[model samples]
Target: MKLRVFNIIKNTKVEGPGNRYCIWVQGCSRHCRGCQAVHTWSHKGGELYDVEVILDDIFNQKDKIEGVTFLGGEPFEQAEALGIIAQKVKEKGLSVLCFTGGKLEELRENQINKKLLDNTDLLIDGKFIEKLTDYSRPWCGSSNQRYHFLTDRYNEEIFTKYKNKVEVNISKNGQIFMNGMGNFDEILRKVDLMGIK
Candidate 1:
């Protein structure tokens, strides 16, 4: 299976409970207004990477990471490919966290989506609602989004700790990227004013 990858962050503390390798899969069907990642909304964009190769990359740095996180375009949109990768990651004893625009019940109705959910330890679900923008929940873009803990690996307290916190990274080439749950428009505007990107 090959996944259409929009971006990858090798290490990040704000993605989950600990340092994590984050994969932002390409393409999103739901183009919610005020979405920060408008660049990732196209289904035809991004490069195709084999699932095994991605797994190898994660395994190579397994010791430095507590788990892997799948963000989007919509991780569930590429359910089959991600499910395979998630399964392999779990085999290596790393936790899996997936963020999806689809609701849990909607995803559960599909066999492939169900497999992806089954492989995930935690799921942050629902479309990002601009009107419901929330700054108090970790790993969730909106108040309407819910965190579903499929396994006992993480607790509510862990989620609360990282809420409203943003992690900003500047690449070697000086491109800027931001992650975490909150209204980041103002902060990003400041970054733009500083001419960082």
Candidate 2:
């Protein structure tokens, strides 16, 4: 299966428990208000790659990462392709963490989600609600989102072990990309005031 990918970070800590390989799949139908990733909403915008190729890349980084994380445009939109990668990764003894804007019950109703859910160690669900925005918890940006421990890999300890944070990545060409969850607007505002060169 081929997956439309918006971006990939070979390793990042703030995205989940321990270091993780994060894949931001392309396209989202939710378009929730105040979404920071409008750039990922276009279904046709990102490059396509075979699931095997993605699995290869994940394996290459397996030694350094604790697991893989699927966040998106909407990971469930490309569930089957991601499921292939997730199941393979789990077989390798690495965990899988997935984020979706839809609730768990709603997702469970879809037969295509079986493989993905079965393989995902941690699943974060629910759309971002602007008014209910709260960053106290780890990873999830809004209060409406809930975390599900589908496997024994992770549990409620995450609440005490982690907190909302962001990682700043600057590529060789000077492109700055930020990931993870928090109040980005305020963070950027503070950065602007500092005027760092």
lDDT, each prediction:
0.87, 0.92
lDDT value, candidate 1, whole model? 0.87
lDDT of 1 by residue, 1-197 (tens): 78999999888888887899999999998998888788898999999999989999999999999999999898888999999988899989999999988889988888878678888998988888888887677777788988899999887877546656788888898877888665677888888898875
Model 1, residue 14: displacement in angstroms?
1.2
- Residue 85 miss distance in model 2 (angstroms): 0.5
TM-score of each: 0.93, 0.97
User: Which ten-residue region of model 1 has the weakest summed lDDT?
Assistant: 156-165
The residue ranges of model 1 lying beyond 4 angstroms of the native Cα positions read: 192-197
lDDT of 1 at 59: 95
